[model samples]
Target: MAEEEEEKGGSKKKLFMIIGGVVALAAGGFFFMGGGEDEVMAEEMVEPEVVEGEVLDVGTMTIVLADDDPDKLRYVRVGLALVLDITADSSLVAGRVSLVQDAAITVISEMTSGELRGAVGAADARERLSTAAREIYPDGEVIRVVLTEMILQ
Candidate 1:
Protein backbone atom coordinates (compact mmCIF):
# COMPACT_ATOMS: atom_id res chain seq x y z
CA MET A 1 0.00 0.00 0.00
CA ALA A 2 2.92 2.37 0.58
CA GLU A 3 4.32 1.61 -2.90
CA GLU A 4 0.87 2.34 -4.41
CA GLU A 5 0.70 5.65 -2.62
CA GLU A 6 4.21 6.62 -3.89
CA GLU A 7 3.25 5.75 -7.47
CA LYS A 8 0.11 7.99 -7.26
CA GLY A 9 2.22 10.86 -5.85
CA GLY A 10 4.73 10.48 -8.69
CA SER A 11 1.96 10.67 -11.30
CA LYS A 12 0.54 13.86 -9.76
CA LYS A 13 4.01 15.52 -9.92
CA LYS A 14 4.34 14.61 -13.62
CA LEU A 15 0.85 15.97 -14.35
CA PHE A 16 1.62 19.21 -12.52
CA MET A 17 4.92 19.62 -14.43
CA ILE A 18 3.14 19.22 -17.77
CA ILE A 19 0.51 21.84 -16.85
CA GLY A 20 3.22 24.23 -15.64
CA GLY A 21 5.22 23.79 -18.85
CA VAL A 22 2.10 24.53 -21.00
CA VAL A 23 1.30 27.63 -19.01
CA ALA A 24 4.85 28.91 -19.32
CA LEU A 25 4.86 28.32 -23.09
CA ALA A 26 1.55 30.15 -23.48
CA ALA A 27 2.85 33.14 -21.49
CA GLY A 28 6.08 33.20 -23.49
CA GLY A 29 4.16 33.19 -26.79
CA PHE A 30 1.91 36.02 -25.70
CA PHE A 31 4.83 38.18 -24.64
CA PHE A 32 6.92 37.40 -27.71
CA MET A 33 4.19 37.66 -30.40
CA GLY A 34 1.47 39.87 -28.94
CA GLY A 35 3.64 42.41 -27.12
CA GLY A 36 3.08 46.21 -27.27
CA GLU A 37 3.58 46.39 -31.06
CA ASP A 38 -0.01 47.38 -31.74
CA GLU A 39 0.17 50.10 -29.13
CA VAL A 40 3.42 51.44 -30.61
CA MET A 41 1.91 51.46 -34.10
CA ALA A 42 -1.17 53.28 -32.87
CA GLU A 43 1.05 55.90 -31.26
CA GLU A 44 2.88 56.48 -34.54
CA MET A 45 -0.29 57.02 -36.59
CA VAL A 46 -1.11 60.70 -37.23
CA GLU A 47 -3.94 62.55 -38.95
CA PRO A 48 -3.22 65.17 -41.59
CA GLU A 49 -3.89 68.76 -40.58
CA VAL A 50 -6.42 70.70 -42.60
CA VAL A 51 -4.79 73.82 -44.05
CA GLU A 52 -6.86 76.95 -44.61
CA GLY A 53 -6.35 78.34 -48.10
CA GLU A 54 -7.58 81.15 -50.34
CA VAL A 55 -10.76 80.67 -52.39
CA LEU A 56 -11.10 81.54 -56.10
CA ASP A 57 -14.55 81.60 -57.55
CA VAL A 58 -14.86 79.67 -60.84
CA GLY A 59 -18.36 81.15 -61.30
CA THR A 60 -21.67 79.32 -61.81
CA MET A 61 -22.48 77.12 -64.77
CA THR A 62 -25.74 75.68 -66.12
CA ILE A 63 -25.08 72.43 -68.00
CA VAL A 64 -27.50 70.48 -70.18
CA LEU A 65 -27.37 66.68 -69.90
CA ALA A 66 -28.68 64.28 -72.50
CA ASP A 67 -31.74 62.37 -71.33
CA ASP A 68 -33.43 59.13 -72.38
CA ASP A 69 -36.64 60.97 -73.24
CA PRO A 70 -36.48 62.67 -76.60
CA ASP A 71 -38.75 65.57 -75.62
CA LYS A 72 -37.45 66.16 -72.06
CA LEU A 73 -34.20 67.84 -70.99
CA ARG A 74 -32.05 67.46 -67.87
CA TYR A 75 -29.68 70.08 -66.49
CA VAL A 76 -27.42 70.86 -63.57
CA ARG A 77 -26.46 74.28 -62.26
CA VAL A 78 -23.30 74.36 -60.16
CA GLY A 79 -21.32 77.14 -58.50
CA LEU A 80 -17.65 76.30 -57.99
CA ALA A 81 -14.73 77.66 -56.00
CA LEU A 82 -11.08 76.64 -56.05
CA VAL A 83 -8.96 76.55 -52.92
CA LEU A 84 -5.41 77.75 -53.48
CA ASP A 85 -2.40 78.23 -51.28
CA ILE A 86 -2.30 81.62 -49.53
CA THR A 87 0.77 82.62 -51.50
CA ALA A 88 -0.32 81.04 -54.75
CA ASP A 89 -0.45 83.16 -57.90
CA SER A 90 -4.10 84.08 -58.49
CA SER A 91 -3.25 85.33 -61.97
CA LEU A 92 -2.57 81.77 -63.10
CA VAL A 93 -6.17 80.72 -62.37
CA ALA A 94 -7.81 84.03 -63.19
CA GLY A 95 -6.18 84.20 -66.62
CA ARG A 96 -7.44 80.66 -67.33
CA VAL A 97 -10.76 80.70 -65.48
CA SER A 98 -12.63 80.14 -68.72
CA LEU A 99 -10.65 76.99 -69.38
CA VAL A 100 -11.43 75.70 -65.86
CA GLN A 101 -15.10 76.51 -66.37
CA ASP A 102 -15.08 74.58 -69.63
CA ALA A 103 -13.58 71.55 -67.90
CA ALA A 104 -16.21 71.77 -65.16
CA ILE A 105 -19.00 71.98 -67.69
CA THR A 106 -17.70 68.99 -69.59
CA VAL A 107 -17.46 66.83 -66.47
CA ILE A 108 -20.85 67.76 -64.98
CA SER A 109 -22.71 67.63 -68.29
CA GLU A 110 -21.69 64.02 -68.89
CA MET A 111 -23.30 62.64 -65.71
CA THR A 112 -26.97 61.64 -65.56
CA SER A 113 -29.32 63.02 -62.90
CA GLY A 114 -29.14 59.73 -60.99
CA GLU A 115 -25.31 59.85 -60.86
CA LEU A 116 -25.44 63.27 -59.22
CA ARG A 117 -28.03 62.43 -56.55
CA GLY A 118 -26.48 61.82 -53.12
CA ALA A 119 -23.49 62.91 -51.05
CA VAL A 120 -21.35 60.24 -52.68
CA GLY A 121 -22.28 61.59 -56.10
CA ALA A 122 -21.37 65.11 -55.05
CA ALA A 123 -18.04 63.89 -53.69
CA ASP A 124 -17.37 62.04 -56.93
CA ALA A 125 -18.13 65.18 -58.92
CA ARG A 126 -15.77 67.19 -56.75
CA GLU A 127 -12.96 64.66 -57.24
CA ARG A 128 -13.49 64.67 -61.00
CA LEU A 129 -13.41 68.47 -61.08
CA SER A 130 -10.24 68.53 -59.03
CA THR A 131 -8.60 66.10 -61.45
CA ALA A 132 -9.73 68.17 -64.39
CA ALA A 133 -8.42 71.36 -62.80
CA ARG A 134 -5.09 69.71 -62.07
CA GLU A 135 -4.72 68.87 -65.75
CA ILE A 136 -5.19 72.54 -66.66
CA TYR A 137 -3.12 74.03 -63.83
CA PRO A 138 0.36 73.17 -62.59
CA ASP A 139 0.80 70.93 -59.58
CA GLY A 140 -0.01 72.67 -56.27
CA GLU A 141 -1.73 75.54 -58.05
CA VAL A 142 -5.19 74.23 -57.14
CA ILE A 143 -5.29 72.77 -53.66
CA ARG A 144 -8.91 71.63 -53.63
CA VAL A 145 -12.12 71.91 -55.63
CA VAL A 146 -15.12 73.27 -53.73
CA LEU A 147 -18.74 73.10 -54.77
CA THR A 148 -20.30 76.38 -53.59
CA GLU A 149 -23.73 75.46 -54.92
CA MET A 150 -25.11 72.51 -56.89
CA ILE A 151 -28.56 71.86 -58.32
CA LEU A 152 -29.40 68.74 -60.31
CA GLN A 153 -32.62 68.47 -62.29
Candidate 2:
Protein backbone atom coordinates (compact mmCIF):
# COMPACT_ATOMS: atom_id res chain seq x y z
CA MET A 1 0.00 0.00 0.00
CA ALA A 2 2.92 2.43 0.79
CA GLU A 3 4.48 1.67 -2.58
CA GLU A 4 1.20 2.41 -4.37
CA GLU A 5 0.87 5.73 -2.47
CA GLU A 6 4.45 6.67 -3.38
CA GLU A 7 3.78 5.84 -7.05
CA LYS A 8 0.61 7.97 -6.94
CA GLY A 9 2.53 10.90 -5.46
CA GLY A 10 5.24 10.54 -8.14
CA SER A 11 2.62 10.60 -10.92
CA LYS A 12 0.90 13.62 -9.37
CA LYS A 13 4.21 15.45 -9.19
CA LYS A 14 4.90 14.64 -12.87
CA LEU A 15 1.45 15.94 -13.85
CA PHE A 16 1.94 19.15 -11.88
CA MET A 17 5.37 19.66 -13.43
CA ILE A 18 3.85 19.26 -16.91
CA ILE A 19 1.11 21.81 -16.12
CA GLY A 20 3.67 24.23 -14.73
CA GLY A 21 5.88 23.81 -17.80
CA VAL A 22 2.94 24.55 -20.10
CA VAL A 23 2.01 27.70 -18.17
CA ALA A 24 5.60 28.92 -18.21
CA LEU A 25 5.82 28.37 -21.98
CA ALA A 26 2.63 30.30 -22.56
CA ALA A 27 3.82 33.23 -20.47
CA GLY A 28 7.18 33.24 -22.24
CA GLY A 29 5.50 33.22 -25.66
CA PHE A 30 3.21 36.06 -24.68
CA PHE A 31 6.12 38.21 -23.58
CA PHE A 32 8.37 37.34 -26.53
CA MET A 33 5.66 37.85 -29.13
CA GLY A 34 4.98 41.45 -28.03
CA GLY A 35 1.67 40.56 -26.37
CA GLY A 36 0.19 44.01 -25.73
CA GLU A 37 2.69 46.29 -27.48
CA ASP A 38 1.84 44.82 -30.91
CA GLU A 39 -1.68 46.18 -30.79
CA VAL A 40 -0.61 49.65 -29.66
CA MET A 41 2.20 49.81 -32.22
CA ALA A 42 -0.10 48.70 -35.04
CA GLU A 43 -2.65 51.37 -34.22
CA GLU A 44 0.02 54.06 -34.20
CA MET A 45 1.56 52.82 -37.45
CA VAL A 46 -1.76 52.59 -39.32
CA GLU A 47 -2.80 56.17 -38.82
CA PRO A 48 -2.00 58.31 -41.89
CA GLU A 49 -0.76 61.87 -41.72
CA VAL A 50 -3.46 64.49 -41.73
CA VAL A 51 -3.57 66.60 -44.90
CA GLU A 52 -5.58 69.80 -44.89
CA GLY A 53 -6.87 70.78 -48.34
CA GLU A 54 -9.86 71.86 -50.40
CA VAL A 55 -10.91 68.93 -52.57
CA LEU A 56 -12.48 69.66 -55.96
CA ASP A 57 -14.13 66.76 -57.71
CA VAL A 58 -13.49 66.96 -61.45
CA GLY A 59 -16.02 64.18 -62.14
CA THR A 60 -15.74 60.99 -64.23
CA MET A 61 -15.18 60.44 -67.92
CA THR A 62 -14.96 57.48 -70.31
CA ILE A 63 -12.36 57.49 -73.07
CA VAL A 64 -11.36 55.10 -75.84
CA LEU A 65 -7.82 53.81 -75.40
CA ALA A 66 -5.30 53.84 -78.23
CA ASP A 67 -4.65 50.12 -78.55
CA ASP A 68 -2.50 48.63 -81.30
CA ASP A 69 -4.94 45.79 -81.96
CA PRO A 70 -7.61 46.83 -84.38
CA ASP A 71 -9.70 43.72 -83.72
CA LYS A 72 -10.53 44.65 -80.12
CA LEU A 73 -11.94 47.80 -78.58
CA ARG A 74 -10.48 48.98 -75.26
CA TYR A 75 -11.60 51.86 -73.08
CA VAL A 76 -10.88 53.35 -69.67
CA ARG A 77 -13.30 55.17 -67.40
CA VAL A 78 -11.56 57.49 -64.94
CA GLY A 79 -12.67 59.91 -62.25
CA LEU A 80 -10.43 62.60 -60.77
CA ALA A 81 -10.39 64.94 -57.78
CA LEU A 82 -8.04 67.88 -57.43
CA VAL A 83 -6.65 68.62 -53.97
CA LEU A 84 -5.91 72.31 -53.68
CA ASP A 85 -4.19 74.22 -50.91
CA ILE A 86 -6.41 75.65 -48.21
CA THR A 87 -5.50 79.19 -49.31
CA ALA A 88 -5.97 78.42 -53.02
CA ASP A 89 -8.83 79.98 -54.95
CA SER A 90 -11.35 77.28 -55.80
CA SER A 91 -13.32 79.52 -58.16
CA LEU A 92 -10.31 79.73 -60.49
CA VAL A 93 -9.99 75.95 -60.54
CA ALA A 94 -13.72 75.53 -61.13
CA GLY A 95 -13.71 78.02 -63.97
CA ARG A 96 -11.06 75.98 -65.79
CA VAL A 97 -12.60 72.57 -65.11
CA SER A 98 -13.10 71.96 -68.83
CA LEU A 99 -9.42 72.36 -69.50
CA VAL A 100 -8.57 69.89 -66.72
CA GLN A 101 -11.11 67.38 -68.11
CA ASP A 102 -9.71 67.78 -71.59
CA ALA A 103 -6.18 67.23 -70.33
CA ALA A 104 -7.18 64.07 -68.43
CA ILE A 105 -9.03 62.64 -71.41
CA THR A 106 -6.14 63.35 -73.73
CA VAL A 107 -3.62 61.76 -71.42
CA ILE A 108 -5.64 58.55 -70.88
CA SER A 109 -6.67 58.21 -74.51
CA GLU A 110 -3.02 58.20 -75.57
CA MET A 111 -2.16 55.32 -73.23
CA THR A 112 -2.42 51.71 -74.49
CA SER A 113 -3.75 48.83 -72.37
CA GLY A 114 -0.25 47.59 -71.54
CA GLU A 115 0.70 51.01 -70.22
CA LEU A 116 -2.26 51.15 -67.82
CA ARG A 117 -2.25 47.61 -66.44
CA GLY A 118 -1.10 47.86 -62.81
CA ALA A 119 -0.37 50.16 -59.88
CA VAL A 120 2.61 51.66 -61.64
CA GLY A 121 0.50 52.50 -64.65
CA ALA A 122 -2.19 54.11 -62.46
CA ALA A 123 0.41 56.18 -60.61
CA ASP A 124 1.97 57.22 -63.88
CA ALA A 125 -1.41 58.36 -65.10
CA ARG A 126 -2.02 60.34 -61.91
CA GLU A 127 1.36 61.99 -62.09
CA ARG A 128 0.84 62.92 -65.71
CA LEU A 129 -2.60 64.32 -64.95
CA SER A 130 -1.27 66.34 -62.04
CA THR A 131 1.52 67.69 -64.17
CA ALA A 132 -0.92 68.73 -66.84
CA ALA A 133 -3.18 70.47 -64.32
CA ARG A 134 -0.28 72.17 -62.61
CA GLU A 135 0.66 73.76 -65.90
CA ILE A 136 -2.78 75.30 -66.17
CA TYR A 137 -3.14 76.33 -62.53
CA PRO A 138 -1.06 79.04 -60.86
CA ASP A 139 1.92 78.28 -58.66
CA GLY A 140 1.08 76.75 -55.27
CA GLU A 141 -2.56 76.38 -56.31
CA VAL A 142 -2.86 72.67 -57.12
CA ILE A 143 -1.47 70.38 -54.43
CA ARG A 144 -2.07 66.90 -55.83
CA VAL A 145 -4.29 64.90 -58.10
CA VAL A 146 -6.25 61.99 -56.65
CA LEU A 147 -7.59 59.27 -58.91
CA THR A 148 -11.03 58.59 -57.53
CA GLU A 149 -11.90 55.86 -60.02
CA MET A 150 -10.09 54.02 -62.82
CA ILE A 151 -11.59 51.12 -64.78
CA LEU A 152 -10.14 49.62 -67.94
CA GLN A 153 -12.21 47.46 -70.27
Each model's lDDT: 0.86, 0.89
Give the per-residue lDDT of model 2 (tens digit) for 29-115: 998887888899888889554454799999999999999888898999899999997778889879998999999988989999889
Q: Write the per-residue lDDT of candidate 1 for residues 36-76, one digit (tens) a residue.
A: 88889887896545464779998998998755776778988
| Per-model tally of clashing residue pairs | 0, 0
Q: CA lDDT of 87 in candidate 2?
A: 75
Misplaced by over 4 Å in model 1 are 1-52
Give residue 110's lDDT in candidate 2 (0 to 100): 94
Which prediction has the highest lDDT against the true structure?
Answer: 2
The C-alpha TM-scores of every prediction are: 0.64, 0.64
Cα shift from native, residue 56, model 2 (Å): 0.3
**Candidate 1, TM-score vs. the true structure?**
0.64
C-alpha lDDT of candidate 2 relative to the true structure: 0.89
